[model samples]
Target: MSIERAFVTQPVPFADALGVLRAAAEESRLRILALLSEGELSVSDLTDILGQSQPRISRHLKLLVEAGLIERHREGAWAFFRLCEGRAGLVDPLIAGLDRQAPPLSEDQARREAVRAQRADAAQSFFARLAPKWDQLRSLHVPETAVEAAVLDVLGPRPVHSLIDLGTGTGRMLALLAPRAGRATGLDSSHAMLSVARANLERLGLARVDLRQGDIHAPPFGRGSFDLVVVHQVLHYLDDPARALREAARLVAPGGRLLVVDFAPHELEFLRESQAHRRLGFAAEQVAGWLADAGLGAVETRDLAPTAQAEHQLTVTLWLAAEALVAAGAERAVA
Candidate 1:
């Protein structure tokens, strides 16, 4: 990513100035900008919050988009609206200067909070239905900040040409490690999860990321590419975990490293029945052998176990493997 520059808020010419002002002059349209500044919202979400008809909400959105005050993107079957960077610069300062304690806007802010609460409830229900035990196991581990810090420590400060995150749920790994690479891609199988990842990426302004829906067992990528490949907490969900590892290994460029993160060996049979996890965890030898079978050289492994104060804990293991620098031209790990 490049350096951020300040917004140059110059006045608009005579002809378009009126149009821009008119777009924000309406009661409904002004509130739209206020809500969007918080996060992207769908037409349905706006309709629900404003207690307005779909046609009326869509009409206001059309005017806002025409005025360049906001932008729209279609993901899967839903269209989401968010504030544009350049245009938002012109509007946000004025919005921030407004008396937020005013009558109608104060009430609108209350409604917005209610909408966000409802959305959070729905997201929790969705995840619980999909992987209850996995969520439970997540609580048993050491705090996530420590795990992410260890992952960063393992990945030295050297910059990379490209990186890929397999099973990139919520795009956290790509977001976490993207600064170390020139470009990064995140692949996932679920559309619902991809939508969540897309929103997070757009919110953070990480424009260099490319996302696609694909199976980890047969990733859609060129052979011997990607300076780094990551399989983070994905194997537990798959039936043929080795096949996915082999596929991930195939994408590692020569001299490149493959990082795998997952729970260490554990007696969590409940995960299989409740969370749809096919494997409880992996042994150091189990994953090391997989890397060897996939033609990657074993490097090192680290186990970050919880402290004595923490009961019902799961030890997280991280394994780093590499493709020999001389073997980039070799055929051992090619797709």
Candidate 2:
């Protein structure tokens, strides 16, 4: 008589909950929450810390507030947001779950973070001085048309699904390859250069491009991530060009290619001191050796004839190398 049927309720679907949670899981939103946990911060405080526009930060904060995860307090002219008490009950467990799944930051990440900080500072100073005359400064380098044509010629008729442009100064190479590739990533150590690159890409209405602050010798990208890797006019600036070449090769996917365009052997003492050139120029043989050491083969080097004569008389050379997985494996076995 006491054994009446007991009712049970089904658990909530994690997929639905995750959908809601993911909306708040964005980089800017998460950063805002983490910083607010310390104490109240004005929009300006967030702007400086996150290096984003005030409107951008405000929008993210509004999303969090609307999500019931944070509450905002107005103190005079300033508005600050704080984590909601009961919301932490939801957020804490969620974060703990994520913590367990997250991997520890690697050494490369640490080094990149440091370099990013330095570049940010340097970029601010560099651009502050150069912004007024950026057009003139850019003119000192090769023309956009010529640079674009050179890159396209080297690319040839090959189908490129993914590409990485090392030292993507002003995103010139990224722009040229963006239409052909499914994804294009640009890496450079100078934040100033990346800033210009990002602006250029944005102006061209290209959104599927990623730019990272990193050195050529030790790129931030994962190994073997790109089907086509390019290093244009960047090798001579690095202290270790050979290591940089190897890193470029490492990023090449099997059956993919690496294209390098830089100056061949030439004397430019002024560039060496003024522009921080590591070497006057690289020899084709030297480049071949580096590519060979990196397990790449079928190297082809071409010296592009200059269209006009100038004071520098720079000799532009294009080196094309391929990384075939089957051939590489055979070589490894023989060794």
- Identify the candidate with maximal lDDT: 1
Runs of candidate 2 with Cα error greater than 4 angstroms are: 1-144, 307-312, 326-335
The residue pairs found clashing in candidate 1 are none
Against the true structure, what is each candidate's TM-score? Answer: 0.62, 0.61
Instruction: List clash counts for every candidate, in order.
Output: 0, 0
Q: Please provide, for model 2 over 158-255, each residue's C-alpha lDDT reduced to its tens digit, 9 standing for 90 to 100.
A: 78878899998878788777767766778887656776665566456563366666778887668789989999888888788899899999999978
| Poorest stretch of ten by lDDT in candidate 1 | 1-10
Residue 306 deviation, candidate 1, in Å? 1.9
What C-alpha lDDT, on a 0 to 100 scale, does residue 142 get in candidate 1? 83
lDDT scores of the candidates, listed in order: 0.79, 0.69
